[model samples]
Target: MAVGLLFLVCAGAVLYSAEAQDPYSELPDYYKRGVDLALEQLNSHAGVHHHFRFLRSLDKSDIESGFGVRYLYHHFYLKPTRCAKGTTESNPQTCPFRNDRPLMDCAVCYKAAEDQIEPSPKPYVHCIQKPRLTQDMRTARTDHCKKMTYNSGAPTLLAVSTG
Candidate 1:
């Protein structure tokens, strides 16, 4: 009986570790978010409450759900500007982002959109603009990111930019 219990414990540990270490599980948080967006779109049944909360968030409160979809937040320019490359810029286009950590970059990104940043003290990114993006602009902007992430393996706007 004791061996059976011990075997169960060991089996559980192996399963848990395997789940944690699965190569498919290695994608960053924003990648997971992109997947969630696709899943959310596919599920179409996750309901409006969360979507409303995200849309209504004066600050994008629920975006943190991006378990591996971090890359979605990166902003690109048709032309690179003087923004420094190694620190968090209140604006990625006009400022700098410290590449020390991708999450830090994500935080800085939230600051610019200011639409979504988990309500927090000392949040890394701070919005300097009133987020003038209209609903159309926001949709366009988000779609840009989503497209890039969803079709990362395919040619993208950035690719067009560079091409």
Candidate 2:
């Protein structure tokens, strides 16, 4: 009986210690009060709502930068929208649109190699989605690969890493 009791105590202590490591687990008194006040105004009727696509795109950019989305957003876009929407790779002329490069650099040339893209795309946020290229433009994947590999080190592309 004593052995079982001791074991229980030890297990409880281990659990408590593990949880104690997080300073914000319960938040400080000031934070708790702030949270209470904030929640006071929040009810079932009121909510912060946004589409998953929008949030996901935002998160993807954030994760890619590994820093505050705001910081990356500011440095890259020169405002705060480029990370998710678009930023130019080289000259703002060739592949001059948002989210142009794959990864940091969208599969730009890769885009050309695959097929002609889309039609007239209206601008959204900071950048506009590009219209599909004509058939003659995407004659060969190799051509695109060449261009994609080329990086002009534009201000946006070469700026400081926010992360």
Candidate 3:
């Protein structure tokens, strides 16, 4: 009985120690408080009423710059909800028309290859999804790739950079 009790205590201590290593907890108290306030404000002001959980924060670093301002980025995602009428197809353009506030923008990336290349194969397609913003231009670029690649005399079957 003593041995079992001691094992349980050791296990509990290990678990506690593992959880105590939170990186967020190491952040400054003021920064943590600011994050909390920002989350609260977003939840309150957003049209949808749901728990907005913190996703992460990122900083954009430029290589050709000196010790400039260090920008911190934060992101959040909404908890799953029962209001699943048409949330999957929500976008900025269609959301307003459907009288719904979009939770996020939908971004799509496509990849394609030529049809007759024996080694390259045919009907090569790929897709990626990203959050869309007001400035995103959703232009179909299949023809653009074909034209651009045709001039270089090389296989233009790859993912094109968007910038």
Give me the candidate number with maximum TM-score.
Answer: 3
Q: Evaluate residue 36 in candidate 1 and report its C-alpha lDDT on the 0 to 100 scale.
A: 31
Best by lDDT: 3
Where model 3 places Cα greater than 4 Å from the true spot, the runs are: 16-26, 29-34, 55-70, 75-163
Model 3: per-residue Cα lDDT over 1-163, one tens digit each: 9999999999999999996554445544423433444444444554544333222333111111123311111222222233332343442112212223334322211121221112212211211122443232323333332333322344442232211
Q: What local lDDT does model 2 show for residue 130?
A: 23
Which pairs clash in model 3?
105-132
Backbone clashes in candidate 2 total 9
List the candidates ranked by lDDT, beginning with the highest: 3, 1, 2
RMSD of each: 18.3, 19.3, 16.6
Instruction: Please provide, for model 2 over 85-118, each residue's C-alpha lDDT reduced to its tens digit, 9 standing for 90 to 100.
Output: 2233443222212343222111111111112221
The runs of at least 3 residues in candidate 2 whose Cα sits more than 4 Å from the true structure, single-residue gaps closed, are: 1-5, 13-25, 44-163
lDDT value for model 3? 0.32
What is the Å distance of residue 104 in model 3 from its true position? 8.4
Candidate 2 Cα deviation (angstroms), residue 6 = 2.1
lDDT of 1 by residue, 1-163 (tens): 9999999999999999885443223444533333333323322443311110011112122232234322224321111123422332553333322333212001122211223223221222211112333566555555544343322353332333211
